[model samples]
Target: MKHILLIPENEKPTLTAAIINTLLVSVLLIALFWISLNQIQMTLDFSFIGTYRIRLIKGFGMTVALGLIGFIISFFIGLLSALGQSCKILAVRYFCNLYVMLIRGTPLIMQIYLFFYILGTAWGIENRFVAGILILSLFEGAYIAEILRAGIQALDPEQMEAARAVGFTRKQTVRFVLLPQLIVLTVPSLTGQFASIIKDSSLLSMIAVIELTQTIREITATNFKLFEGYLFLGFLYLCLTLPITLLSKRLERRFRHEA
Candidate 1:
């Protein structure tokens, strides 16, 4: 008896479809963009890239600074919250659950207003940048906590056992073994949440924070160039988020290959 099977070089069905779809999408996007280019009104001074670009450049720097500080604080707080949720101590887990629920369930703009207006007002600290950063950090912390929690749970119990057997304390095991793997697994999710924070930073427009979106609106209002100013702001936002989105994809690919 003879039986034969032939497999294509790209044997995976998903991969083949993915390749075809990607090519189609690229062609379609190029065609669309070429057509759209003719319609874009550039009545504003295109030569004004330097002067008009300054606010966005500075705004992007401030936005990046905001993301960095907020992500750092949020991730740190998330780590502790994840640990609390995972702790054997019942009260710790209960309180941590409450913290996550409270933050995740609330409307972020309201939280930002209240935190900055009510709480911050009481302290006489009405700094928009500081207020924006803290509110975002608090909001993002909940989401990051859940991401880290899931990452930790995805690990094999044996990995923790192995670390424990290697004469490592609980702290050392988590620091050396768990945290590294958790970070690798959660990078994509964290990047998305980071982007969310940047987009949400637009809400700070309520308080007149001079971030990109707010500044652009102000410029457009003054110049009566709504579309142009907003188009510029939209580009600035793409600049902020596109790199992270691409980086996240690259990270996912690297980890997939490693795994």
Candidate 2:
């Protein structure tokens, strides 16, 4: 014998504060969109946007690839610069410092222009893509060198002392004891630098590298959809950066757990 419980179909669920808040947010967003549309007085034509979808996709890929290649090259440059800065030779240290200072002091666009012109003149390298890689790597290398230097310096001096006590030479100590810890300490900073490099890659479009920003410019020039074009470009960049940011956070957490 089962007692049948009959629920009234006319009963309505009460709206929670969370649901009300979400509704309010949606309404606010709709209002903002209306305001923007009225102010701009332009039709929201996504047809133009779709026209350059392939180019945008290519540019997005190129931007990410360029950033990654630049990051790798800059890391090596930074590592070498860091090692050189810590060298016994005063001349090498001074040269490394000069390189860092020179790059840091100048504008990135100026660096790109100079690299393009000077490298073109001296080495017959006229490819803007190649030039962009070199420029970004060199620009980021200086900053990354400082980051690496700080990471290396942050370590307890006793570690190096213990390594030397165990018959490790100066080079061996750096290779084994110093480098592994340096890598862990510098990961967060390097991740930030990589993000910075991706943003900086947009400037390469000025040199006709046809990356994301260039694609945006090309699209907007066709339909005068400047706002939408830039908004889309910004979204594409966010798409590229957000993943790296999340991954960096995850890596930081994982490393912290391991430590």
Candidate 3:
């Protein structure tokens, strides 16, 4: 008699199994959290949520607006910076390289202080909301630049050679051959970066940007419900980020399948 395997290799889990696992893990986490809270003799009170509902809604809107606007501006900045890095001109290449290095090396909080206090003061950027958006864009742009640069560099050299052999001009080659593939390759990563933008926008609260975090901070300050306020804050952020995270994974799988 031949030995038989019980399951197929690399088989995907059934929907029912996935659902069951999800519920089990969720229940385990909730139980552990409840037990920990009981040990600490602390109970969470979300009663303040109803009172501060309007402010929370406004703050949530501001955060979403900031993230959307920042991502758009930063994407263009990143694209140009990525292209500049590969340019033949030494000055452009060095400038782009230095930008990526400085931004990535330093903490964003420091940059925020430097830009808002010094640069914004000098330039007369009096509006804190505008200043925050610019700061977030510049900070995130460096990271996006590196992502795009990696995507560009990862493209197969043979494709370029093939384009040239087919008498495709540089512009034609880029537009027809390179741009489409680069977009496809980098999109999943870029989507994930948008989620990062949402989380990082919280840091803008330090500058009094009046986004979700700042709103929660102000509420907790008055009500002294720090635990409840922050717990709700985490839930609100999950509402924003979790969907993007799932979409990023789905895109990665779909693209990988296509390839």
Candidate 4:
């Protein structure tokens, strides 16, 4: 014999504070969107269009060049450092760790000022872009090293043992098996590193390198159009960052698919 129990067909759940807060946030965003569109329409003037376009194009190109070169240098430094830290030699590991720690501890902007302004042209290194790249490379190199190390270390110990067992020498294992695999796994981290390099390029403005942020600041100062300048800059930054974000997502998907 079984006892039958009857309950309400649809039980209503009580609204929590979190739910209320989410609704409030949605409403606030809707209102902010409406306000921003009105202001954007009023402020987006293309007066002095040719000059402004030239300034922006030149600045954007410089920014991209700096970021790309820095990414390459940083990636190289990071790989070497990551490998050195993971090396069997005690001296190699210790020195690599020390370098990583020192670089990570310092502020990137300070590094830029030190390299570009203090160590100027007469010191046989006057080019602002060159100094900017070196500093950015060193700054982001520390972080990218950690990412590479993690990606390498994330490989299974069994896989390494299997490589060794299969008559692969240590060097052969690293080159043929470990490095190729690490490069694939490190794609997301490298994308993040690239994005960081791009944003950090803004610090070059302090040394008057005329990157995108510097151009925007200069333009806003003359036009007294701070709001519009910032809005445009935000859009530019988004444009720069969004591709890296998509690439990272795509790489993640590919990795998952391969797995």
Q: Pick by TM-score: which candidate is best?
A: 3
Which candidate order results from sorting by lDDT in descending order? 3, 2, 4, 1
Candidate 2 lDDT over 44-79, as tens digits, reads: 666766777889889888999899999999999998
The window of 10 residues in a row where model 1 has the poorest summed lDDT is 1-10
RMSD of each: 5.7, 8.9, 3.4, 7.7
Model 3 agreement with the true structure over 114-198: per-residue lDDT tens digits: 9999999999998999999999999999999998998998888898899999999999999988987787789899999999999
Model 4 over residues 178-208: C-alpha lDDT tens digits? 8777877888778977988999988888888
TM-score of each: 0.79, 0.81, 0.91, 0.79
Give the lowest summed-lDDT range of ten residues in model 4.
1-10
Clashing pairs in 3: none
Which regions of candidate 4 are displaced past 4 Å? 1-30, 33-51, 87-92, 119-123, 169-172, 257-259
Candidate 1: the clashing residue pairs are none
- Using lDDT as the measure, which candidate wins? 3
Taken over the whole model, the C-alpha lDDT of each candidate is 0.80, 0.86, 0.92, 0.83
- lDDT per residue for candidate 1 within 1-259, as digits (tens), equals 0111223476554655667667878999977866776677334444444666778677677777777888899998898999899789999999999999999999988888888889889988778888888888888899999999998888878888999899999899979988777778888888888887788778877777787777777777767767567767777788888998898888888887543
